[model samples]
Target: MSEPWTLHPDRALPADPTVRGIAREVYAATRDLSIVSMHGHVPVEWFAQDSSFGDPAQLFVVPDHYLTRMLVSQGETLPRLGVGSTETEAVEQDPREIWRRFCAGWQHFRGTPTRYWLEHAFVEIFGVTQRPSAATADAIYDQVAARIESPEFRPRALLDTFRIEVIATTDPAWASLEDHTRLAKDGYGDRVLPTFRPDPLLHVDRTTWREEIDLLGRAADVEIGSYETYLAALRVQRQRFVEAGARATDHGHLAADTTPLDDLEARRVFDAALAGAVTAAEAEAFSGHMLFQMAAMSTEDGLVMQLHPGVLRNHATAPFAAFGPDKGYDIPVVTEFTRSLRPILDAFGHHPAFRMIAFTVDEDVYSRELAPLAGVYPALRLGAPWWFLDAPDAMRRFRESATETAGFSNMSGFVDDTRAFCSIPARHDLARRVDAGYLARLVAEHRLDLDEATETAVDLAYRLPLAAYPAPR
Candidate 1:
């Protein structure tokens, strides 16, 4: 039989003896720092309800696209994993069976960040000793299922256990924020905050845009008939989010364009969209204009703007239709930020109240565009490597690329951007380890003193995030 899998204490540290020694010390200093997740996709309801997770499969396999997408890649069906299934399609009802399938395919996750996180949760969080395999699938599932039934495994309880100082949940602009209100009442309001996402409101071409517009109007208690009222509704909702303890607004667009149109042209496009006569070109232009408007609002309201563009969302239409959005079909595209965001940056780049963290999957722009932009602009900060680039090597490459130009302070530290609640600490842990390794190399090279490298590591792990996204006063 194969030996049981075990995580190394110095995992993800530099391989060189000199650098590794420095890395070990650096990693130890920030290993237990309080996690500051300023941007993420965790559901606010999870904290408000403080409910126990259903089972091992429900907690791991079903909801995580990172797990399910890999399973789908290796000849598995979504329904079999307890994901979205049509009425005609048969769905797997047994959580045990789903867990078994996940465990059986354990080897498929080798060399993936998902693999590292799952192992961390298994060994550190759940006390699983045996490595997952077809033979051990049932036993591991029972162990995980039993562990999740404990009160400590519940959402809010896990917050303290994970040492999460602050975690922001992404919520739609039209959201009522009733759950956030409940959390505020429960004294978790400051710890678990909301992030306003206005993608639906900006994209006039979407099929649900009209419905979302009406919902926004009702939620903001505003009468929306024209572009002016639409802006008013968005402003009202943003204020509501701020009142609910939101410190930032999140935007994800296909591109980072922020050119604004004249009032008449903007009104014309809005009227056309309202009349269901807007062309695709017109809609795209309107979306860009809305982004500029969002920036202007951010300057006024002090909500830090976070823009992560350059994704061709729902690349595989078939999977999107079957499983709905965020089922792991979003593919990265070559994103241009310098020319595309001139309008917004030129307007608010030096504004004292304006702040924006720019994120990208396109590493090509790290040194060439984003780093240089952030290095100079007081309002702009380079977001940490995100999505596909959140892995170990990619993260190292990001620091090597951006730190030279943008420097440590100009970076937004690390944003987990995760939907998996349990994976939060694991992701932050990976980031902290990677940053320590990078700083260790600098120390080994004599470019930075040992004390300087340690301070920078602590800043990256804690202080930078707090400074980047300040809580609403």
Candidate 2:
């Protein structure tokens, strides 16, 4: 029988004798550093309730799009994996069946980051000694389920176990933030913070735009009559987020365009959108204009702006119609940052109070446009490899591509951008190991001293995230 699955001590390190030795030394310094997840999609309710994850399938299979998407590609249906059922499809109700399907397809995740993260979580978090397979699925589930029932596996308790110094949850602009308020009173306000995400509000062409606008108006306690009042209401909501310990604003638009329209044009579009008569071109223009407006707000409010563009969200209409968004149908397109972001960069690139981190699913832009732009812009730092590019080889390629021009300081370190709470530490661990391997290459080439590489590794893992997204004052 094959040996039980276990994480290798030097899993992601270089294989060359001298470089591998150097990587081991670099990894040691950052192996246990406190995680600073400045940006992610982890639900606030998890920490608010301090609840136990229901079971292995619920925790690992149901909510993780990364896991679900891979399974769907292999001809597995969504309902079988416990994804929400629709009228046309009946969802899987038995947790054991979902776990069995996941284990049977474990080989699909081979050579993927999901596999690395799962292995890490199994070996490190749950102390699972056996590999996931059809034969071992039930046994491993029993082992994990037994441990999860313990008090130590509770959401709040796992924060200490995961060594999460600070984690930020993405919140809609219209969110009440009552849970955040409760968390603040419970003394976890700073540890678990909120990030303002205004995507729905900014995209006027969405079918639910007017309803979202009303929700925003109610949340901010502002009566919206015109575009000016709408902006004011948004400002009020941003201030609310700030007071709730938010340090950053997250924007995931399809493009990086930041061109602002004239006052009259903006007013016209707002009125048209309110009346349900706005054109697609006008809606697109307004969203780009709002990005410029958001950059202005960031300058005034001291909230860092995180822009990750170039995703064509919900590429498959059938699944999207059935399951809704974030079911892993987002596809990357070629994005031109140099021309598209000039308006915002020219406006706030040198501003003292403004800060922005640019992330891209388009890795082709890393060396060509993003690195050069980030190298000189005082307000901008190129974000770490995001979404599809967050894998090990992709991360190594990111360092190779972005470091030449942007250097280490101009990079946003590692932002896991995950929604899976239990996978947080594993995701961060992968990034650190990848960075150590990259820095070891630099040290091996004599471009950086061993001491410099070691210190740089720590900064990438810890200091840079804090500096880029400072705690809200």
TM-scores for all predictions: 0.98, 0.99
Candidate 1 structure lDDT: 0.93
TM-score of 2: 0.99
In order, what lDDT does every prediction score?
0.93, 0.92
Tens-place lDDT per residue, model 1, 1-473, is 77776789988899999999999999989999999999999899999999988999889989898898888899898889998676677889999899889988999999989998899999989889899988999889889988899888899989999999999999999999999999999999889999999999999989999999999999999989999999999999999999999999999999999999999999999999999999999999999999999999998899999999999999888778888888747889999999988999899999999999999999999989999999999999999998989899999999999999999999899999998888988999999999999999999999999999999999999999999998755
lDDT of 2 by residue, 1-473 (tens): 77766778999889898999999999999999999999999899999998888899999999999999999899998989999786778999999999999999999999999998899999998888888889999999999899888988888898899999999999999999999999999999889999999999999999989999999999998988899999999999999999999999999999999999999999999999998899999999999999999999998888999998999999988778888888738889999899999999999999989999999988889999999999999999999998888899999999999999999999888999999888899999999999999999999999999999999999999999999998544
Q: For model 2, what is the C-alpha lDDT against the true structure?
A: 0.92
Checking candidate 1 for backbone clashes, the offending pairs are none
Span of ten consecutive residues with least summed lDDT in model 1: 82-91
Off by over 4 Å in 2: none
